[model samples]
Target: MPARVVVGVVTSDKASKTRRVELNRTVQHAKYGKFV
Candidate 1:
């Protein structure tokens, strides 16, 4: 159980970073009409 919790935390940290990057890129594209 503890191992699963630790793994979940690590996976979430990675996923959040990727999601944030994608969201930032999309917003920048919408504003500038170009890929950022």
Candidate 2:
């Protein structure tokens, strides 16, 4: 018989509310100018 195990990092580096808002807004604005 054999056993297998798996692990991974399920977390976010940005956890601050204000910073998260700023980061998301910046990304959204940048993507808005990109032509897809």
Candidate 3:
């Protein structure tokens, strides 16, 4: 298999044991516009 491109955001880093990651995504709307 081939490697794919991925994007993510770090929401929290205060924890010493683990990290919190928030996946990024794009969405299109007719009136509301684009959202992350």
Candidate 4:
């Protein structure tokens, strides 16, 4: 299998050596057949 590259955004950077990252993606539900 091959790896996938996802683009994310840095939401916060308040801590000295810590940061917050946010990634948005769409996923399909198994039973309901809906995208979430």
- Candidate 1 stretches with Cα past 4 Å from truth are 1-28
Alpha-carbon TM-score of each model against the true structure: 0.18, 0.20, 0.44, 0.66
Candidate 2 C-alpha lDDT tens digits along 1-36: 559444445345566552322121223346568533
lDDT by residue (tens digit), candidate 4, 1-36? 659888899999999999999999999999999999
Give the C-alpha lDDT of model 4: 0.94
Global Cα RMSD, each model = 12.8, 12.8, 4.2, 2.3
Candidate 2 local lDDT, residue 21? 20
Stretches of candidate 2 above 4 Å error? 12-36
In model 1, the Cα lDDT at residue 31 comes to 69
Positional deviation of 30 in candidate 2, in angstroms?
Answer: 42
State the displacement of the C-alpha of residue 16, model 4, in Å, after optimal TM-score superposition: 1.9
Instruction: Score candidate 3 by lDDT.
Output: 0.80
> Which candidate's TM-score is highest?
4
lDDT of each: 0.38, 0.41, 0.80, 0.94
Model 3 vs. true fold: TM: 0.44
| lDDT (tens digit, per residue) of candidate 1 on 1-36 | 465321122223346446222122223477668856
Residue 15 C-alpha lDDT in model 2: 66
The candidate, 2 or 4, that scores higher on TM-score is 4
Least accurate 10 contiguous residues by lDDT in model 1 = 4-13
Which candidate wins on lDDT? 4
lDDT of 4 at 26: 90
